[model samples]
Target: MKATLPRWADLALIPAINLLLAFFFAGLVVLFIGEDPIRAVRILITGSLGSSYGIGFTLYYATTFVFTGLAVAIAFHASLFNIGGEGQAALGGIGVTLVCLTLDHTHWLLTLPLAILGAGLFGAAWAFVPGYLQAKRGSHVVITTIMFNFIASALVVYLLVNVLKVPGSMAPESRNFAAGAHLPFVHEMLAAVGIKVSRTPMNLTSLLALLAAFLTWALIWRTRLGYELRAFGFSEPAAVYAGIDPVRITIVVMLISGAMSGMMALNVVMGYQHRLVLDYVGGAGFVGIAVALMGRSHPVGVVLAAILFGILYQGGAELAFEMPSISREMIVVIQALVILFTGALENLTRVPVERMFARLGGGG
Candidate 1:
């Protein structure tokens, strides 16, 4: 009989494996520090779900992760590793901040789309530079994109510290954005329904992030452009033989990735901070790579993965505060372990070493 498995089985296995690895790695860290692993684990779980504020914080972090995760996933689908998400997101934040500070209108109806669009355009432009270089000059995108991240950081610092620095302000940030640029808080709206949340950060940006994921899923799985991009990703030579233009697809994919990064500004600019500031993206761009990998570059998986990261981030901070021995950096260790295990999963399943272990067990 031919062996078969349900599609859902395969889908469910990834998360199961990831969670197992995460716990095992975290447990090891706890052991090394001479702390009770179970207690640490319990603290992490309760801190994240024990209160309304904790849940709100989790979702708030998820908003940034989901947006940047989509950026990474989009590039992965096209077989292009666009590592310039940091720079792209920074530029996007700058774009929106400029518009928010300069625009005289206080109506969100006019400012919201414009702010998002400006950020998207800035991010697309930032990414297009590398795409053009890769397509025309045969430059390696990985190296160029990494360099661009440094350049973007320097550019933003200069703009914030020198050019856009608000007069008489002793900070390295911009002035508060116009009221119209702020995202609506869900908690405030919930008051009308008699559902009160104490000390929450939840906002409408989470809803936008979900909508972005759905749109990205439809684009990748149900559209012609997505088909061509995936075809190119699988095999560039084959794509060319099939009359697909690899160069154009490469540029287009980078633009889409950059645009997604640009949307990340919504989490900070519109969702939390009413103004753009230095380090607004807060390393979310780099974390997005882990999210994309954990999700296997699928849209739905990306959302789930983003949520997991968000939980770890918020929970780990709480753990650090409550336990004198534990450090918030443990979250980074956990993330690194997840990436290593997931990266090796495919190869581990095919290795002959595994077969020997299986044979030894079966002989018993």
Candidate 2:
């Protein structure tokens, strides 16, 4: 008989244990560098969660990750490896830029939805070609998507430098967006209610991210289409045998994934930066892959995983600043260890856990 675990244990306990192992090894690395690992951890927690400023920044970063994580998770449900989130997000920025620039004089309520629609459509368009290639030509989605990321970077650079650069501006960026296009900062919102928060990028987009997570959860687990997608992921042959069209499903899945990836632009570009700049994505696209893996492609898990990474980001900055001995590269190393443990090495801990549970009257 195949070993199994209860849903909660499989989803929560396993990932938690793996995460602890990652952090334990990360602490050892700090010790190897002659630094007190405990102090480093203390600094990390204090830096990320000790102040309202830190919490605001952490949530801002988490908001972006939520969108990208959902993008990855949606594709994963259909057994599609969408490595093109970077490209899709970049293109989404372009879409947002176009919408904001055109509606610079309009009310934010009108501009925001239009910008969102543009971003989603543009992102979906970017992913459609790769989806087509995969479904029709037998091309590998992973390879195609990765290649598209490079193409996206190049395309954005070209557009910014040659077509979209603001007149008389030296930098490769557009003109500042109009006030009507601005998303209200979280600090301002809180202040309106007599609650003080540090000025940070957290905004309405953060709420949108939360809403997206809930909607994703509903779409994935409570819908018939979600069932089909999951069935396809489990076995394409089985899906086909049940009369589901693989080509159609592949296309639909990629479109949805691309739209989610593109939506990240709203938080970073429209909500925070208020202008289009080169390379604004800053690797959040790839980070979403790690988030999805750690979260097991579930929306709730993705949000929690994204928050953890946000803590790492905010805390890592503190670690680098406070202890010059621990370089920023060390932070990357720590993140990699987390990814390695939770993703590629997950089965190492999971198998043993499953066995232990099996012996304890738990079915696996």
Candidate achieving the largest TM-score: 2
RMSD of each: 3.6, 1.1
Q: Sum up the clashes in candidate 1.
A: 0
lDDT of 1 at 75: 94
Query: Highest lDDT, which number?
Result: 2
| Model 2 agreement with the true structure over 247-325: per-residue lDDT tens digits | 9999999999999999999999999999999999999999999999999999999999999999999999999999999
The residue ranges of model 1 lying beyond 4 angstroms of the native Cα positions read 1-10, 344-346, 349-364
Candidate 2 residue-wise lDDT at 83: 83
TM-score of each: 0.92, 0.98
Q: What are the clashing pairs of model 1?
A: none
Q: How many pairs collide in each candidate, listed in order?
A: 0, 2
